[model samples]
Target: MSAARLASASAATAHQRQWFADLHQEVAAGGDLALVNADAPQEIFRAMGIPYVVNQWWSSIVTAKRRAQDYLGLLRERGYPDDSEQYSSIPLASAFDPDPANAPWGGLPRPTIVLAETTGDASRKIFDIWDTQPGVSFYPLESAAENDVPARWWELMPRDWERAVGSDRLDLMTGELEGLIRFLEQTTGRVFSETRFAEVMDLVNEQQEWNRRTRDLIARARPCPLPVNDSIPSVMIPQWHRGTTWARDAARAFHDEVAERVSTGAAVCSEERARLMWIGRGLWFDLDFYRRFEQSHGAVFVWSMYLAIAADGYLRYGGDPLRALAARFAAFSDQLYTPPWSAEWYVKEARHHGVDGVVHLVSEDARGSYFTTRALEAAGIPVLELHADNVDARSADGDALTRTVGDWLDRRVRAGD
Candidate 1:
C-alpha cells in the first residue's frame, strides 16, 4: 500500500479507537448494576427494584469465531454496527448513553453485579473490586454452588463491599422464581396465568432448540479451517444474553446471515486481516488497548468475547419450564467448571474455530484459568496469558498490553515463523 493510503488507514483505525474510548468514558456515567444470565435472574434485585443485564446469548456468540471481523460483519448485517456516535457492542446494545450518572445505560451502575458462567479465583478478585462491589453479582447457573444452595438459598450476603468478589466467589442460582413471580405481578400489575406460564415454557423451549441447532453450526462454524474475523460476533452475541427471547433470536439470525454474506462475497475485512481469538472477559478500561495491536502490527482484530452464547446457549432452555431450567443450568456447569471437562471442551472449540493462536486473560478474581491455559498449550495451539480485569477498565495499562500483544502477533500470526 502507498504511504498516503497507509496513513489514511491508520487514521481511520485511530478514529475508531478514539470513538470507543469516548464511548467508554461516556458510558461510565451510569454507575453500575447486578448483571445476570438466563438461568440466574436476580429475583431479589428485581424485587428490590435493582436493574440487571442478562448476558446469556451475548456471551456465547463472541467466543464462537476466531476473529473480530466476524463479529463486526454480523453486527453490520444486523444493522447495529458503530456509526457516527452509536455503538452496537453488548454493553450498549440494550441501552445507551444519556447521562450515565443517573441511569444504568451510559453511566456504569451502583453495585454493578454481574452473572458469569464460572469465575476463577483470580478472576473473582478482579470481579469483587470491579464487577460486584460497587454492586452485588452472581452466576444464576453456577451449578458448583448446588451443594450449598438448598441451605443458603440466594441472597446478597454482603461480607465487605468486595469480599465475595475478592475470593472469586459467585452467588449462583436460578433465582427466587417463586418469590419473583409475586414481585413482578405486583410491580407490573399484570396477571400471569397458566397460559402465561406456558408462554414462558414455550420461550424456554425455543431457546433450547436454537441451542441444539447452533452447536451444529459451532462444530462446523470454521469453514476456513481457520476462523474468520466476521464470524465470532454472530455466534457469541445471542448466546451470552439468552434470557430475553430477542437476544437469542438475534444471535441465531446472525449466523445464517453471515454464511450467506460469505456466499455472496461481502468483504470479510479490509486487508485480509489475520485474526485472533480473545478467551476471557473484555478489558473494559482498555478496549482500544485491545485493538491497538492492530495498528502497531497491521492486524485487524476480528473477534473477542461475548456473542456466541447468544447463538447456542439460547437453545437449552425451552421445554418443560422447571425441566428446561434445570437442563440449562445442568448444561452450563457440565461444561464451564471442572478442569478436565472445561479445558477439553475449549480445545475442541479452538480447533474447530480455527484460530492461529489464543490469548487468555487471567484476572485476580478468576479461578480455573490455569487449566484452560494449560490445555490449549498441550494441544499445540500458541497461547498468550494477559493478567487484567475484563470489566475494571481502570486496572489495565493500555500501552503495556499493546506492546506485549503486538510482539506476540508479529511472531505468531503475521510472520508465521
Candidate 2:
C-alpha cells in the first residue's frame, strides 16, 4: 500500500489549483500576466502586484497531465528541435497547440510579457520564440559566469551574500534588476517601491527559514517521516509563491506537520531498510516510481532538491534588498549544477540524511552529474545514475528504469546486508 499523503501536501496542491484557476480567469478578463523562468527574479513581480506564472512550474503541470508530447510535437512540426531543453521549451510549444481547449489548464493564457535569463543557447532560442508571438514581449537577462568559486555556499548565502556571490557579479545583476524594474514600471504604469520590495524579501526569507527547519527535521528523522513525493509539493508549491504571508504560513505548517510525524515515529515504509536520495528534478510523469521500491526493496527516497534547495539556495540577508535579490540569482544555477559546488552539497546532504544509496536522475540539460556521483562515491555512498529527462517522458521507459534500479539496489545498495 502507498503511504498516506501529507495533509500539508494535499492542501498545497489544492491551493495551487485554485490559484491557477483564478489566474486563468483574471487573464480572460483582460488582466496582464507574466511568464517567467524558474530562475527569474519573481519577487519583483510579486511586490509590483503583477501576476506571474513560472515556466518550469507550468511545464511540470503539462508533463503531469501527459500533454507534453502533444506540445513537443508542435515544435517538431514547425522545424524546431523537439529534444532540446524540453523543460523550458514545452510550454512555448503549447502556444501552438492547434486546439486551445484541449491544452492543459485551458492552455496557459497568452502572456503579455515573458521573462527569462539567457542561461544557454537553446533556452535563449526558446524564449526568443515567445517574443515573436503577437502579444508577447520578451525580456532576457544576461547570465553572468561565476568568477569566484566558494565553498559551503549555504553557510554564507544568508548573511554574507556579498562574499557568497562576489561583489562584481552582484553589481552586474543589481544593475540588470534596476533595468527590469524600469521596464516593468513603464509597461504596467505602476511605480516601484523599495520599501515594498524589502517587505517581500523579508517574507521570502521567513518562508525559506521554515523550509530549513523542516529539512533539518526530516534529515534527523531515521525512519523518514515524510515521503519525498509528499515533501516535493508541500515545499515547492509554496516556494513558487515565495513572497506572500500565505506561503510563509504554509511553510511553517508543513514544518509542524513533519515535526508531529517524526515525534510519533511515523514512517513511510515501516520495513524501511535502505534510505535513498534523489538528486535531480522530479519525475513528474512517474512520481509513483518513488514508491515502487518501497514495497519490493524496502528503499524509501528521502531527499530531493526541491525542499533542500529552498532551505539552502534562496536566503539573502543584507540592507540592499535589490542587490540581495540579485545575489540570490547571480550564481543560482552554478551553486546547484556546477562541479565542486554541487558535488560538495550532494555529499553533505547524503551524509546528513544517512542515505545508503542515491538515485541520481541526470537530465540531459543539467551539468556536472558525473561530478556529483564521484563525490558521493568518494564519501562512501553508492550512486545509481539514470539518464532521463525529468520533464519529458517520451524517451523514458518506466518498466526498464524500475528494473535497472531494482537490480542496482540488490547488487550495490543492499549487498552487504
Candidate 3:
C-alpha cells in the first residue's frame, strides 16, 4: 500500500474503534422511539444498550473474512475481511441469502418498526413478525414517495393501495402513531407539541439531506478504487440508520474526505481496476467478494444500492410528518417491488458513469421476480445475477455463487485481454 492507501486504511480502523465506542455509549443511554425500518431503529437500540445486530452488516463481514480485531469491531465497522477463496471472482459477492419476510438471523430482538421502502408485501411481512412478539411494537409511515405523498394520501390508488393497506392492520398501521403521541403525553408527564414534532422532522430532514449529499459525493468518486472507496458505504449506512450527531458529522467528514481522495487520485492498492455499480439491496454477507473483484479481475466496485437511496429517497417533510413519510413509501412498490421501474434507465445511467458490469443480490421470498437481468445486458452492460438472501446467512448458496461468478469473470477477463 502506498503511504496514502495505508493511511486511509489506518484512519478507517481508528475511526471504526472510536465511533463504535461512541455509539455504544449512546445506546447505553436509552430513549423511547417509534422505529422505522428494522435497521434505523436497531441502530438506536444497539447504541442505547438494547440488544441488536445488523444481519446485513454481519453477513457482509463474514463473507469478507478480513482480519477484524474484535467481533464488536466487525459489528461497529462495516468492513469484514474478504478471505473466502471461493468468492474471489464475482463483481460484488454476497455470503448471505436473506428471507426478507422474517429476521434473517434467529434470536433478534422483537422489532418495533415502520416499513418505508422494500420489495413485495413488505409492510405486511414486517407487521406480522412484530405482531407475533410482545413488548416489541411498531407503526407505519404511509407507503409513498417523498415528493408525491401530500397530494394523494387518504386517497390511495385502488390498483394497489387497498392491498397495501388491508382492513385488519390498516387501523394499527395508521392510528398507532397518533395514539403513541397521546399516550406519551398523558403517561410520562411529557408535553407533546407541534414544535416537538417539528423538531423530530427537522432531525429527519437533516439526515436525509446529509445522505443525499453523501451519495452525490460517491457518484462523483468515479473510477476510484474499491477498497479505498468502500469506506463510504460502510460508514454512511451505519450513520444514517443510527441517530448520532457525531456519526452524522463523521459522515460529512467522510464525504469531504472521499472528495479529497478522489481529487488526489488515491485508491486501493491496485493497478488495473474495472469500475462496476451494484444495484438492488446490498448482499449483506458477500461484501468481501465484492471487494475481491477489484483484486481478482482488477474491477473496483464504485457503488452499492442503499447509499444512493439515502441520498435520493428521503423527503424534506418540513412540518408535516404524515405527508412526508407517506411520500417516502409511496414509490416503494414502483422503485423496488412493483413493475414499471426503469431498470433500463438506471443501468444506462450506470454505464454512462462508466460501469463495467452489474450485480443484483436476489433475496429469497422477495416478491418482485419479474425484473429481468436483460435490462442492463441490453444496455451493453454484463449483468451478473447472483442468488443470495440479502439478510439471512443460512439461505446463501456460497458454492454455487462462487462457481457462477468465477464463470462470469472468466469471460470478462479473457475479453479484456
Candidate 4:
C-alpha cells in the first residue's frame, strides 16, 4: 500500500511558513530575535514573549531545501571542517551567504542573543563563531553528564528526576538557568514572570501528556497507524513552541488523529512484514526514503526518536518549574547519547515495539554508539550501523544506505521471518 500521509502534517508545514513570515516581519520592525540551540530552555523565551528559532530546526529547513551542501561549502571555504556539526552550524554559515535566494526562508535574521549548551568543545566553538557578529551576544550553558547511569530513565525522569540525574549536575544547570533568565531580562528589557513561567510549565506538561497518549497508541497498534515521516513534523513543529496553548492543542490534535486512524485499522503498509527501528536524528533530506522500503520489501519503519523522545524525554513535574526545566535540559544529551543510559533505553524500546532490525546512525561527535549496537545484537536483534551525518546530507549516501538496508533485510530480518 501507498504510505498513509496525515493532514495534520501538511497543516504543520503551512503553520511553520506563516510563523517564519511573522518572525521576519517582527525583525524588520526592529524587534529583537533570538537564535537558540535545541537543548536550551525555550520556555523562557516563550514566557517572555520573545520570538526565537531553534538552530536545529533552521538547519533542517536548510537540509530539506537542499542548501546544506552549499552552506557547508561556504564554511569549508572559510577554513572550518564541512563535516563538523554541520547541522548546528549551517544557519550560522548561511548568514554569511551573499545571496538571499540561495538561503533558506530568505535567510535568518541577525540574532540579538545566541543561546546554546556547551555540549562539547566543538559546540562552544560553533556558538563562539556566532558571537563574532557585531551585535550578537552568546550565552553558553554547561552540559554535564551523569556519572551514575540509571535504568529506565524514561520512567524515572518525570517524577524522580533528581535521583535519575545527580544534584550536582542539577545545581549547575539551575544556576545557569537563573543566569540565562537574568541575561534575557537585561537584554530584552522584558521582565521574567514567575507566574507566567509557571503557567507555561503547566502547558508544556499538558502537551507531553498528549504526546505520551499518542506514543502509547502507536506502540500498541500492530501495523503502525501512522508513518514516521508525518509524525516527525506533526510532533516536532509544535515541540519547538512547547509552552504555548497552541502547541498543546496541536499535540492533542495529533493524538486524536492517530487514535482515529488506529480505530479505523489504518496502516502505512498494507503488508507489514518487518518492523524497523531508526535510532538517531532524522534523515531530513530524504524523508521519502522511509516509504521506499515498504513497497519494495514489506518492511515498515515504525519508530524514530522524534515521537519517542517527545513522549518520554520532556516530562518533568515539580513545584519549581524553572529548576524542573533545568533538570530536563541537564540530562537531555546524556540520556540520548551517553553509555548505559542510552543503550538500555534503545533495547527497551526495540523490544516493546517488536522491532525486527535496527538502523543505528552513529554520530562522530558522540560516544556509546558502539555499545548500543553491541547491546542490540546481544539482545538477538540484527543491527545495521550506518556512519553518516543526518544533517549533512553530503556526508551520507542515501542510495547506498538504502541498498545496504535492503541487503540486511534480506539476509538477517526477512530470512528469520
lDDT of 2 by residue, 151-210 (tens): 898899999989878898889999999999999998878788988899999999999999
Q: By lDDT, highest first, what's the ranking?
A: 2, 4, 3, 1
Which stretches in model 4 have alpha-carbon errors above 4 Å? 1-3
Residue pairs with colliding backbones in model 2 are none
Greater lDDT among 2 and 4 belongs to 2
TM-score between model 2 and native: 0.98
- In order of listing, the candidates' clash counts read 103, 0, 35, 0
- Candidate scoring better on TM-score of 2 and 3: 2
lDDT of 4 by residue, 44-110 (tens): 9999999999999999998898888888888889898788887798888866788865477878877
The candidate 4 region of ten consecutive residues with least summed lDDT is 1-10
Minimum summed lDDT over a 10-residue window in model 1 is located at: 150-159
Model 2 error, position 379 (Å): 1.2
Q: Quick one: best lDDT, which candidate?
A: 2
Per-model CA lDDT versus the true structure: 0.44, 0.90, 0.46, 0.87
lDDT of 3 by residue, 84-146 (tens): 211210111211212222322221222232222232353344344444444444333444332
Runs with alpha carbons beyond 4 Å of true place in candidate 3: 1-129, 132-134, 138-180, 183-192, 225-229, 232-244, 317-322, 342-345, 397-400, 412-416
Give all candidate RMSDs, comma-separated: 12.9, 1.2, 9.7, 1.3
Q: For this target, which candidate reaches the highest TM-score against the unseen true structure?
A: 2
Residue 60 miss distance in model 2 (angstroms): 0.7
Better of 2 and 3 by lDDT: 2
Clashing pairs in 4: none
